[model samples]
Target: MIDSQSNNNHFISESGYLSSILRAPVYEVVQITPLQKMEKISLRFNNIILAKREDMQPVHSFKLRGAYSMISQLSIEEKKRGIVTASAGNHGQGVAFSAKKLGIKSLIVMPVVTTKIKIDAVHRMGGETYLFGSNFDESNKKAIEIAKKNNYIFIPPFDHPSIIAGQGTIAMELLQQDAHIDRIFVPVGGGGLVAGIIVFIKQLMPHIQVIGVEAEDSACLKAALLKGKPVSLSCVGLFAEGVAVKKIGLETFRLCKKYLDDIITVNNDSICSAIKDLFEDVRAISEPSGALALAGMKKYICKKKIKGEKLAHIVSGANVNFHSLRYISERCELGEKQEILLAVMIPEKKGSFLDFCKKIGKKIITELSYRYFHKENACILIGISLANRLNEKKKIIDNLIINKYKVIDLSKDEMAKLHIRYMIGGYPSKNILERLFSFEFPESPLALLKFLKNVSTYWNISLFHYRNYGTDYGRVLTAFHTTKNSPKFEECLNNLGYRFHEETNNPAFCFFLKK
Candidate 1:
């Protein structure tokens, strides 16, 4: 037997086994994918920018490199019985796709609430899925049970030597492409990717720096490093769902602690802004987690005033849902964050709602959504577009505070968005309603079915109430975005026997087409 550990090529190292982790007892091996030099990013400070496009993998993610590498090195018997894993989506898809490619059965356990697109992608990749648990922690527990009960190999998404070594290949390739690289930015989740890269790079050249980037809401590595121990978070925010891990893996933490130079945490707005940059500048679609590294790199280099550096950003994957793009689009400018909430109050009569909009909307109107039911009071929910300047945004809210609109800032709060917002109506209205679900139209018609929480969708309704009450009839109001592209909706309304108000013209119609 040969010593297959990294960094000791000294005496009697198994030249072959040590070289290819695949042959090593508990490690996986991945061949380095070529790196593409992006000259545009390089033009700054004589620094060269190279992007490792891991998104092109067979599973459309770097997870493939780890999954395939790890599975191939497993015991032959383990291979025969196949493998199983738990994932929010990406890792499961990678393992399942790898298993299928290698002619083995595979199982993927995922949270029940995972989006349909991700679920479909896993199925399309030939993974048998077990939708279990409300979240990743529970799904992971279920995977362990299934693995033990069925005597199958448990292929973790991360946190194992084989997986980490496989991920290390990215570092190998990066060095090969730019050996003199000064720094590499990696997105952190369970920390496997960053840990592997740091390990491999450190073993070769201890001088180069490796930075781990994470969503601020889920900076497990940062917290662990700062505390000098791995501590699970009580709660996690999920804007960057890809890297929204509350806990770091044992092996991953150890390796990262040994080799990683620094870890950076970025806000959801910054990550979303980075996503938009990738989309607009590079014609690439990156999930919030994937873009974290790039965003961090951009921020890190600037903050440190370090120029003339060679930087590598791992462009991890692009399995984002199409409907998610709406939010990405809506918030790319807003940095994908808003103080969203619902409000209700007794109508005092005459222009009260407009007063609220005028008070709030005069400065910002990112997205306004509301519906009214007839009664003494009205309820409305909206996502406020906060100003980039905190003080100015606070001013708008301060005004609301003085006016007493019963404003609630849900951007910093998720519990409100999930539970309280829907409760805006009276107990009678809220309890009496069978359901209240809100989702947006996709870029196309199929989008409704694709992204809508339920098949049944109310028409695009934007109903609000004013203080003024008409004696004969209530002024039924609605809003629609019309332009060269609104004819489709207009034709549908025409076929449905609804016409716009003649006075308003141009497809501006209220209930029953203003009849």
Candidate 2:
């Protein structure tokens, strides 16, 4: 436990962050969001689960608190000069709304892939918006340039002291709402929110744990902690666009590294599952980043086998892109382990389908994709709904194996989930050296056209499939007719700049698409 008096004195003397947070005038435009009990989640996990509803704020996010706190403290000259900032989405909306409230001009530079919903929100709040770059880091560089050129004050999204202090106000409200809380799970992006909460909570309630959750693909805070410094990631996942920062801020990382208890990273699937949980229990449609803390909390509880503890998580925002719901719904069942996908090779004969169904018994078949290949055997992609995932999946695979049918568990295959399931079709008529690849490119109006032009110009594209799941990046599965020693092809792909993986030998590809 910390010495409350000494710790408080040390923080106040060193930085006065505690005092700044206490005196923050965020309440002028920010809401004192509710601490809501998640009844269904509580019962399911055998714990008292509470969610701080920051999604209820004016911008539908807690970001406005920090944005307002920093902007409201600016000098008359600074305010007159206006402000410029970079954001993925939510923070831009927060800054736009706050600047409008104070009758100051604001410029928000966001990544080109930012959802239209957020872009429109910024415009509605009277902020001039500029779409730039592919992600936050790139847009951040642009914002700094804009600020300097215009002689406007650059308001950082999470790095500044005022921003951290403003975010720390959430911690003050949390303690007042539930003094008996055992743990607080905060979502980490640039580390502002988690750093703010950790500093305040560790000093005031040292016994209570503060854990930071991050999306695995964009885990800047976790990466920074491991490296002992704030490091920029080569690439970040865009699924949770709000928290897709490539690097943790300097000051925020220092505080988080010192006071944060642990870091948990969850995948997009688990985040989707958490979103579904929030919607079911609270009737709130949370953005992927908003449900991130709950996803990590669920993971932590399962890993520790802890029960009956009072756990709280921040529902940080609800600025969800409507089109993204389709992706979330598709992944949520898999995330919760309520469904399993399999590639089963069965005899291509009459009654084979009936026998397979009989073997599956009462389990619901959610999806079935099959195409005629040869007469001897056929590969089929199947999705089965289940109650107990591990045991049921094992039993199903075992039964299929006992029947002398080859089965491949594709439940965790990214290519299978994203492309193979939909592209089950006959192979080429003539045998050719086909190499398969999966590519991810930034989503935009002309991204597909550019990708097609770049890829098809050099190589003969034997197979191609592209789909938009309302994410910042588009997933494309394409195949090229090339020999194994095509060094030139590899060199060209290197120059292409998009992130890609070779899936030539993938089992799903072999079963479903290979000649």
Q: Highest lDDT: which candidate?
A: 2
Model 2: weakest 10-residue lDDT segment is 1-10
* Most TM-score-accurate candidate: 2
lDDT of 1 by residue, 73-153 (tens): 666677788788899867888887787777889999987667777778888888899988756878999998998899888
lDDT of each: 0.64, 0.88
Model 1: how far is 284 from its true place, Å?
0.9
Checking candidate 2 for backbone clashes, the offending pairs are none
User: Residues 395-460, candidate 2, lDDT per residue (tens digit)?
Assistant: 888998998989999988888888988889859989999998999978777877787777688789
Native-structure RMSD, model 1: 13.6
Query: What TM-score, computed on C-alpha atoms, does each candidate reach?
Result: 0.65, 0.96
State model 1's lDDT: 0.64
